[model samples]
Target: MSSVANWSCTATATIWRSLGKDETGDPLGYTEPEQILCDYEGGLSKKLASLGAEIVVKNTVWTEFALAATGDYLLIGSSTEPDPVVAGADEVRQVIRYGDTFERVADDYAILTGI
Candidate 1:
């Protein structure tokens, strides 16, 4: 099946992932997630990008990929964009979990697990 970006990403969410501060009170850096990162029901994973320091993640919503209407799997790096990314399966733009409530840790990134 082919990927589609037919849906408009009209919604936006602001999540506060706890970041550790240095002695000067600056962010040490973003944390990484353990287990599987999910968006809605979609399990998102990280992939390397051509752009320097940029990363991509899956935008899938179904456990079974074939079940999804279209593959829009996409972005994670402090993204200000409102919607998910639509790219190749081997490639992806990560997403944030709207329903997820993460257990903040010192060195841990935000894990998007939902009920």
Candidate 2:
């Protein structure tokens, strides 16, 4: 299938939030992690709220964050652009064929590749 066909499904960021505990396993209405990384706070909260959970974004990072699986709520990003990458025309064309966006974050990712 063409990259565009694959991308037809849309790109999203899956976010999970940890709900504060009330001493028992139940949620205390507030989240313990206290923050989420996103490009937009209101948009993220609105999307999460639609999923029957409320999220308060404390901050946003250009890169994605991974939660440790103790999450209580979940959210998917609504971004249309793909993550950037520095690649030659062939590489870029290949990615385009898969309908994937290749964003090149301005840092040398070689060191962070394994992390």
Candidate 3:
């Protein structure tokens, strides 16, 4: 696998994982926002191709989030950006398949993808 120096750019995102539901079946809460590297691209297309689909990929931004699986929601954007793109668990998981390595970092797990 390539080193971190190979990564071109980076972005910040927010992760929201479900910690089960409350008595009313509502999600508990979301963890504080954490900054991670958005080093990869074309992940969505790669996943579709793996499924044998021939769809045209437009200006889609399939960034890589190497955070722990503890989160179920991933919002890609910077504080300056007007809006953030939210990704569900399945979408994030698909991108994670292209990760380079999986290891434990501190008290959480991390998946490093891209060059």
Top candidate, metric lDDT: 3
RMSD of each: 16.7, 16.7, 7.9
lDDT of 1 by residue, 8-55 (tens): 222322222324568997644332321122223245455554566544
Lowest summed-lDDT stretch of 10 residues in model 1? 62-71
Q: Relative to the unseen true structure, what is the C-alpha lDDT of residue 66 in candidate 3, on a scale of 0 to 100?
A: 43
Pitting candidate 1 against candidate 2, the one with the higher lDDT is 1
- Show where candidate 3 strays beyond 4 Å: 1-9, 40-66, 80-95, 98-115
lDDT of 3 by residue, 1-115 (tens): 1344234335444444445568997756555444454433334333244669653422122334444452244454433222222232121232232444443322212332211
Clashes of each: 7, 11, 0
1-115 in candidate 2: lDDT tens per residue? 2233233323333332334567677754422222333232222221244457644443222223333233233233432222211110001000001112444322110001100
Off by over 4 Å in 1: 1-6, 21-111
Shift of residue 26 alpha carbon in model 1, Å: 17
Which candidate tops TM-score? Answer: 3
Return the TM-score for candidate 1, rounded to 2 decimals. 0.18
